[model samples]
Target chain A: MTEKEIQVREKQEVQQAGEPTKPERYFVPPVDIYETDEDVTVLADMPGVAKDGVEVRLEDDTLTIKGTKGGNGGEGERVLLREFESGHYLRRFTIAEIIDQAKIEATMVDGVLTLKLPKVEPAKPRKIVVQGG
Target chain B: MAIIRFTDRPLFRNPWADFERMRREFDALFQGLTGEYPRQVGGTVYPALNISEDADHLYVRAEIPGVKAADLDISVEGDTLTISGERATGPAEQRFSYHRREIECGRFSRAITLPTRVNPDQVGAGFVNGVLTIILPKAETAKPRKIEIKTQ
Candidate 1:
């Protein structure tokens, strides 16, 4: 009726984009990478992703993270204004050789992926003791 | 003979405008929200979100990671919907200095005005993993209806 009414709502409903046309969309999860005394921890914000749907791989010096989140939408549900489009999360970081890849640990809680990259023995911080005079 | 200095920094290249530098800057945009939740939009906070509406319901979904469900508090009054929660910053153990901290963790609250009227009594929400979904069904009178034309 009025411009205000039309402005509030979208003119038309947006149909869900199905595969066979456009490829899957990937979003890089927000991440915090910091190194501690003994480990390099990376916290990635990946909401809507389940623990089992996530995959972490370390090959060579590259560490890759992939997660597929489900349950953003349902069948027969017409989307009017789409914002949080559901899809896959992909991010890869080039790691240094000093990291102990074998000891890398990953934990997912409340959609955040916590990756702990333990440092090698030589890379860990070692305090030197001074002899008393 | 004059000695030439080997500098990896490109000559005339402004560090501020570099692609990687710009991205890193963009990532840090939300780092300003490392405190209590403020009551303003674009204040730059964690967990980007999307609010959309359909004929029968208005939907709001927010990206919240590493936050427990119990820590989240969602409420709706009138046309305003608010999602407030806290995300633990890091591991309990004290770690080393931060090489780079991009992800924001702390108190965050987002209160937005809905595009249409909804029944507060019929509001439904779901928190799975880290995504919080709020489904507010439109009031009966809010839904649009089709009118028929009669033949002579």
Candidate 2:
């Protein structure tokens, strides 16, 4: 085939890690975290998760992200090829004290969750001008 | 006596990289010990796919997170269905540093040879919540037909 074939990867199920209180299978959603001067942003890929199904929580220094996938195929659909399995998502991160928890903002778009943690104002550097005597 | 001042500055190296590397090592070790890892081939593809079918239509679903519908292109030729698209990178800023970078962003194209023949003109596709679904209606020749029993 001249065209490059997209590889198939099965989602890794979350096992022996952060077991949810509810009895449901979960997968570790892949994430990307980048830091700018003002804030540190986190982008997580939670496919099939709608805006109403995702939840973000910050307790102490741990940031937790959880998302529930809606559903797979339509009614009475037969499976021909099952490379990917649908499941809920769960992941946690240890945030630093420099982040201003009060100003953290999160948004979901197209099954991707973006969390922006702005830096505390006091932590930013300030310039001091000197007056010549 | 001199005092050393500490400031809340970003680390030079990404801390998450260590965690990821260690996790991969652990996974490899466990896979070697048990020889029963679900995904024998590690890492990931551009877009993972799942194919299902109904009586009339064959559905092909792909998970392409962070991809916009406008950036995707789907074409069908004969028995081959191709999904090609570019996943744009995060905000364009040279000053930004990354703690964890796992998302793959670039031009990606995947072509699949459908299990059965489909009507090229009737193919329909939709994108929602980072998932792209293409519904390919089976050709008339491919659908099952029933014949009434003739009695003497």
Candidate 3:
């Protein structure tokens, strides 16, 4: 075999190795995190997401937020200027020990999903009372 | 005989000043009314508002989606505050083939006249996510004060 043929064979192997076996499309929702004394709020911009269309599920140690876009049953030929197309979003976050799994609350309003996670009572600071000696 | 379409104008009218006064009243009523959000955008309408109190500081929050930090313009004058930004749709050819478009793309300006005077020297603005939050501290005299009560 010629040296050029060996080089071509090596290049083919490298290209095959780089290609993913089962490619999965992932969507990352833009999130804004804010912390106050009471709890930490996470506001995620999930446009075109409806309450019934969204699926918030927790499995094992991963929390997933999935949703379908444009479910309003409006079908027509219309011109679109700018598009924000997020199809079947599936975002998973590894659950941390600091998060209160049982008390997690999620609400969807105006295509914005807000998740309120209250910290555990033991994790919060408590004011100590001083007694007069 | 030819029939002419009768265009009946007002028989009697008030003077120019009286008409101006009525127009002002109508304008005030329209200005006080709450405006409805544009239905084309899928998200909620975040109106840029500047709020101030006689006793405390002021805080302003503006809803600007699909707008980057570079597109914002904020200015303050005395108690008047203004926020202007543009949400461009980019090149026309690039946007012509979009499948679904929900976000609004255009120029938006919101001007608010604060109820109470604020300290112009201490004004701060920050943008996070798509919300623009502006903090304005109150002047020394405008802040809340506690007066001592004497017991005789």
lDDT of each: 0.69, 0.80, 0.53
**What is the DockQ score, from 0 to 1, of model 1?**
0.25
lDDT, candidate 3, B1-152, per-residue tens? 97755665355644585776687567546643533111233322234232323235566644454467687888889888887766654334332333223334566665667656778888888765454667778777777789899999
Better of 2 and 3 by TM-score: 2
lDDT of 2 by residue, A1-133 (tens): 4444444446777765642455456888888998887998999999889999989888888988999888765557766665566678999899884778789899999879999989876656779999899
lDDT of 1 at A26: 68
- Against the correct fold, how does model 2 do in TM-score? 0.76
Top DockQ prediction, candidate number = 2
Q: For candidate 3, write residues A23-122 as lDDT tens digits.
A: 2223556555545555655555564466676777667667677655543221231212111222344566665435566888998765567777676666
Q: Which regions of candidate 2 fall more than 4 Å away from where they truly are?
A: A1-10, A17-23, A123-133, B1-45
Residue pairs clashing in model 1 are: none
Q: Model 3, which residues run further than 4 Å from truth?
A: A1-133, B1-55, B91-96
The DockQ figures for the candidates are 0.25, 0.36, 0.01
Of all true interface contacts, what fraction is found in model 3?
A: 0.00
True contacts kept of each: 0.55, 0.69, 0.00
Clashes of 1: 0
lDDT of 1 by residue, A3-115 (tens): 11100111121123232244445677768888877888888877778889899998878888988777566444544434344567888889874788778889888888888
Q: Model 2, retained fraction of real contacts?
A: 0.69
Q: How displaced is residue A72 in candidate 1, in Å?
A: 3.1
Query: For every model in order, what is the iRMS?
Result: 10.8, 4.4, 19.9
TM-score ranking from best to worst?
A: 2, 1, 3
Question: Which 10 consecutive residues of model 1 chain A have the lowest summed lDDT?
Answer: A2-11
Candidate 3 DockQ vs. native: 0.01
Looking at model 3, give its docking quality level.
incorrect
